[model samples]
Target: MARVKRMERVVALTKQLVDHPYQLFSFTYFCKKFEVAKSTLSEDVLAVRAGLEAYDLGRVETLAGAAGGVRFIPCHSEKANEEFLTELALQLAEPERILSGGMIYMTDLLFKPQLVMRLGEIIAQRLRHLEPEYIMTVETRGIPLAVFVARAFNIPVVMARRVGQITEGSTVSINYVSGSSKQIQTMALPKRALPSSARVLVIDDFMKAGGTARGMAELAEEVGAKVVGKAFFIATQEPEKKMIDDYTALFVLKDIDTENRKIDISPL
Candidate 1:
């Protein structure tokens, strides 16, 4: 194959594996299909990973244990995060996606663990390089995928709650604007959730106007934790472009016409 053609195949294959994480795809299979030796295939994999990093897509991970394999992690690039987020902004505008309560209906997308996990991989991969001490998210919905990302890097998971409980003990709370309502909402964390100077990566399922994100960031600050980065599965369009300036997203949904049963999703 020509240089350009071979490079394209490398990129395509990387995306395939990323689109399906936890499932192993042996290098041997690609070696045979591409009619290339293991060494050359390895080099191609590196190239693909580098290309992704160059574009803020993610990174490649090669497992070495008995059940080892390659995987793609969609980590945000420092350079292209804004452009990537703009793509997500576009996807949130679809007319059909708005719910009766005005809350975006994303239950279907959030329920798909495979896709969510992969999306988590992208968020995890980007923060992994930053070497954050832990991944943080709000209680309930954000926990599932936040836990996944924490597990991905073998790091601990810290969850903030809408209300404090005796079970969690001593806590800190911060008032942040709710992304959906543009009203202040309280988010709390256990005093021991993290230590001073520890690095934190904030994550959540969806971002409408970034109130929740700002809240979490504020909480991190109160605890003396360093808010290193933030990311989400889907970031909706921001009419005012409120506080979530330094964040990344897997994709954006725009123009959701629920009455039309139409949805549009694309990389951000």
Candidate 2:
């Protein structure tokens, strides 16, 4: 095989690191793959790290010593996060998005792959310090967000079902009151989906009273797992109180005037 040029090696290294966020790769492994000296690979890695830092794309972290390796950590700048959330809040505040019941129609926005991918990155970056072992969410709209966050951490996503499926085998079920409707709702998860003592990060699309988010945390406790953090795409400010207290949300929904066809929302 021909020896790869410095520029070509640096680009390839960047691609590999970005494609597998949070995954550690040893210097020896890359040195062998590119048929280059350890010194050459070190310089290439420095170049990749500098480029990533310059653009605020993410981070390239290197560990030293015998059990050392390099990995990519997905991150977003505060300014970038603020700008994106501001634009998203504006888009969501459009009068046409308001429903008859004072609810904002956001299905279209939640399902967009590109948009949700960015949302996931923002959430993941903020919560990455918690070092959650798995991303947990209920079935449906929250799945995409959970998957993308899990991708950023190189972890698995575990989903609870609204109704237990036979395919899941034996499962644990729990009933909790809806924060908004005040009605009892049941959610279940497979016994084997999560292991004991695992750290869980609960994520969801929206929160009104945080009933669903609370239910997920309770379910995690039932499985002997700890709820390290909770995150949401949007949370309402009306209730003033929620079932869960510690949570991060990208946007706050302050009010929806059905009569006037107006929605009041802002980035948090």
Candidate 3:
């Protein structure tokens, strides 16, 4: 194979690292792939790291040791995060989003691939310090966001179901009240979905009374897993106190005036 140029190597290296964030790649692997000396590859990696940081794309981390390697950690600058959240808040605040029961319609934005991907990056950046081994969420709406966060961390997403599936075999179940409806609900997870003593990050698209988030935490505990962190894309401001005290929410929902068809939401 012909020798690859420095510029070509840097671009290729950036793509691989960015595409597989948090996945470690050994120097030996890259050296063989590029057919270049370790010293040359080091310079190429430096250039790639610099470019990524300059653009606030993410970060490239290098670990030293026989078992250590390089990996990418998805992140964004504070300014960038502020700008994106502000724009998203504006969109979410539109009057048309108000539903009949004072609920704000957000299913569209939650499912948008491009939008949720960025939200995932921001959430992952905030919770990365926890070093969670798995991303957990309840089934349905929150799955996409959780999946994206798992992708950023290069980890698997474990989802709990509203009702236990026969296929899941033995399951752990819990009954919790709905913060909004004040109705009792049941959520369950397969015993095999999460291993005992693993660190878990609970993610959800929306939180009201925090009952669901609290229930997820309980589910994690039932399996002997530790709840390292909890995150929500949007959380309501009322009730002031949430069932779970520790959580990160990108946006706060102030109120919704169904009578006037208005929404009061803003980024935090």
The TM-scores, one per candidate, come to 0.63, 0.97, 0.97
Give the per-residue lDDT of model 3 (tens digit) for 93-135.
9988887766788899999999999999888887878999999
| Better structure of 1 and 2 per lDDT | 2
As a whole number from 0 to 100, the lDDT of residue 249 in candidate 2 is 92
What does candidate 2's lDDT look like per residue over 1-268, in tens digits?
Answer: 8866889889999999999999999988998999998888888899999999999899999999888989998887899889998999999999999887668889899989899888988888888789999999998988998998898889999999999999989999999898888899999999999999999999999999999999999999999999999999999997898999899998999999888887899988
TM-score of 3: 0.97
RMSD of each: 9.3, 1.1, 1.1
Model 2: lDDT equals 0.92
What's the residue-level lDDT of 28 in candidate 3?
Answer: 98
Off by over 4 Å in 2: none
Better of 1 and 3 by TM-score: 3
Q: How many clashing pairs per prediction, in order?
A: 21, 0, 0
